[model samples]
Target chain A: MKKFMNTAETMVAESVDGFVRAHADFVVFGTDRQCVRRRHLTPGKVAVISGGGAGHEPMHIGFVGQGMLDAACVGHVFTSPTPGQIIGAIEEADNGAGCLLIVKNYDGDIMNFEMAMEMAAGRHAVEMVIVSDDIETARIGEGRGRRGVAGTLIVEKIVGAAAEQGRPLAELKLLGDGLNGRIRSMGVALTGVTVPHTQRSTFTLGATEIEMGVGIHGEPGHSRQPFSTADDIVRYLCETISRDIDVQPGTKALLFINGLGGTPPAELYLAFNAARRFMEERSIPVERSLVGTYVTSLDMQGLSATLALLTKEEMTLWDAPVATGALRW
Target chain B: MKKFMNTAETMVAESVDGFVRAHADFVVFGTDRQCVRRRHLTPGKVAVISGGGAGHEPMHIGFVGQGMLDAACVGHVFTSPTPGQIIGAIEEADNGAGCLLIVKNYDGDIMNFEMAMEMAAGRHAVEMVIVSDDIETARIGEGRGRRGVAGTLIVEKIVGAAAEQGRPLAELKLLGDGLNGRIRSMGVALTGVTVPHTQRSTFTLGATEIEMGVGIHGEPGHSRQPFSTADDIVRYLCETISRDIDVQPGTKALLFINGLGGTPPAELYLAFNAARRFMEERSIPVERSLVGTYVTSLDMQGLSATLALLTKEEMTLWDAPVATGALRW
Candidate 1:
């Protein structure tokens, strides 16, 4: 797979440089090039922070703007950001109201973000919320957790709104954890992602094959099956989440149909339509929904379906206007 | 390039299905499936409409919403919509204030839209504005016209704002044409798009080669040249447009850096940063700018740079708020 990047090593730095240039109005470079913080930090507000690997272009970087993350500690593609980088964001984004670190449930992310929090513990009040909303590895009886996927956006937006209202750190953490618990996601990859410098996809799916319950980084999924229609894929993904999370009838949830980079908006919509119809048939009340490329893994041809059962308060917070670079409403 | 679509033949229909499903709140299907109109109508406001081939996901359809186009007649991928389909949109979008047809410079589009205008001659007042802002084929002295590319978005946004303010058909057309005249675009093709159903890319380039000055629909550009760094590409594109369009030093212009699908936001920003640097080096004032995947060619991996010299009124209109699915700000 060919790309327009100059080299794999400089892809992240150049991307961050470009991000600042594009959104110079609302964002600025942090202490390091790997970190970016809001241009005008709101005083006395709980600072929200989120980050992970780099392949997911809009996940942490695009979400770092008004009404969302105060800062994002950008790591290399499919590689975790270092503790020093995370510390830079924490130090820059803190405005006297404690900082909240939103971490996806990846081993490297958890370990790195935790180490960074420990480093910043004495300097400032810091908290962490690990989002393991993916149901692909569900083991509810044994108390095993799911991995995080596109559902991070939901936590980001809701927690962001609450933080904007000056919610305490503990409350925001509780809200974030509760939201994460209620959310379940499952994704299918039609193709593998090619890292920048490598010019090679991490994995490969045959012309007529698909991988269900795949991770954002092309992690092995529950099963590999022959390719199916978009409608079928959406239904299967929604079914997996709905069944694993035990979504009850009459439950009002928000449907997040996310594109995995290579997938276009039209395909996402088609998948969303299928998901909506599936939910409707099952008598699940869809309170709200979003369809776009929120969380991506480079240019992988795939889609993830995340259903978050929102409380009344959560719904209100989710509806709050957000002015981020990737998502605005 | 694997896709999630069921078939190429039904790609347009399925995409429209997904579009309507995702945007059921603000838009609805026009009489025909290819045509889409806003759910709410002001009854006496001038109706703005635009369309072309369907592969440009957000161009015509994603733009159908409040503060933008009232209706869009979607054609097949890289193919023109029938005059009958366009006429349906014209009739449905008219709120008794008249309708404006924004046709790109493609011959099929021009002919179809013209025929549609003739079909709606007596029933409603109709006019058309042809956008030939692509400077890739600049031949001013030969009386040759350029092709329309991403610059159409500027025309649509500006004209849509004026129409929202109850501007008449003739005035809206004139404003649209004038804006189109001031805009110039040139795109490069890094990878050809694979239209749905066929499952084959339109064209291919060697690993180290690129098609410069390409049109939106896979049309060949100035020449195929060796690929270069992002900065070099940006400088070359800006220089080509500058040399051909004769952009005077110190002139204020709006820079629109568009991604032709597949390209990430960070990459678009990277390209934008390079573009801004090029303009700065030449002492050209960038009054305003927009960077996004507003206009795309399916899943093509390339970008287009468009610079529009604006008037004071045009600047105001360009800054006006628009609430479209793909371009809301």
Candidate 2:
């Protein structure tokens, strides 16, 4: 497969520099490797930070701003950002109000961010929230945790809004925990994406098949099934999310139909429409919905749906003003 | 070429339905054709609505919400939304707030949206803003008229924020027009994206060649040149945008490094870093920047850069809170 870059080794650093240059106003370099709050540490506002593998474009970095994360430590392509990077970001974004690290439930990310938090705790007030919103059931005996996927965006938005409202660290952590119950995400891949350095597709799927519940780093899904119609796909995806979450009737929901890189909006919408019909037929009250490529997997052609149950208060917070690269509400 | 769908004809409609379902709170549908404001339209807030082909996911639909677009009419894949669809969006979103139709400068989108605007004018207060941000030299002596591409996002964001602040129709049109002078965009495509129904890539580029100035619908670029480093590509792209706008040294600008779908974030940042280095070397002040797959062309492996010269007021508006599908800030 053809790729675009100077060399595989410089890919992550080059991307980070470019990202900082573009958003110089809201993001800046910290400790040579991490992105920190452009604003001076606010004395009272609790700082929120997160990071992970670099492939998810707006995930860790794009989410840094006033209403979301204050810093994001970018990792190597498909690898967790280094603990040093995360620690630097924490130090830079932390105000007297304290800091919260929002780590995805990936092993690499968890390990790196946790280490960073521990390192930071030696000198500063820091807290953390690990988001594990992927609802795909894990193997019964393996004890693997649900992977974090698009649902991270919902978590960031909610918790970020709360942070922006100047919620204290402990309160914000509780809010993050509360939101954990309301969110669930699942994804499927029709085709595998090629890693630029490897110049090889990360995982393989047959032309007429899809792997349901694929991991963001191209991990295999629970099962490989034939490519199905949009409706079938939606039914399968929504069923998984609904089975995992007790989405009751009359409850408002925030639905996110996310593309994993290469899926066209047309296909995304088709899947989105089917999902909506499925939910409506079951009397699920979808309060707000988002469709498009929010979280992606390079050029993998598939989609993920995240459902965020909302109370009036959570909806108000979700409606709060936000300024970020990927989400601007 | 693999595809996803039960039928080609129902693609756009199904997608729209799905978007509405997911964002049910802020999104409302009209007669199975139009998606519009879920916020009760105020009696006098000027509503801004836009639409075009389905391929540009967030352009028309994703912009819907507070401080951006009130509604979007979606067309078939790579096809303009029908006049009826556009008209319905205008009617549904209009609530005494004279509606503003922000159409991209594509012939089909312009023609179709114009027809719909005319159809809606007799019944409600309406206005329009046609965005032509693609800086590619228009057909010979065609003056400033060019196809609209990624720069439309800046236009939509600034103008949408203004409209959300309850600007009148005339003022919103003027704000959009004022933004036109400050904004410019250029793009490169490494590979053509295949439209689902056609099962054929829209345009072709050699394996080691890149198409500069490519259109969102896969129109040919100014030239196909040998693929080069991300810095080289960034220099080429930044030069085009800078020259087009005559960005003087020390001028503050909003830079958008937009993905044309399949390009990975690493390459995007590499290019973004190069562009930043270029701008900094030239002493250009990048006030705010966004790097990601904001506007895309299905799975086209490419990127576009847009520079918006920021006035103090526009910068504030740029920092304003916004809620939409693709962006939340």
Give the alpha-carbon lDDT of every model: 0.83, 0.76
Q: B306, model 1: CA deviation in Å?
A: 1.6
Candidate number achieving the greatest lDDT relative to the actual structure: 1
lDDT of 2 by residue, A116-203 (tens): 8788775778877778888764542225477778988888888888988888899989988888878888888888877877888877
Pairs in clash, predicted candidate 1: B8-B196, B8-B197
Instruction: Write candidate 2's Cα lDDT for B232-254 as tens digits.
Output: 88788888788878664444788
Tell me the TM-score that candidate 2 gets on chain A alone. Answer: 0.94
Tell me the DockQ of each model, to 2 decimals.
0.55, 0.48
The best candidate in terms of TM-score:
1
lDDT of 2 at B260: 82
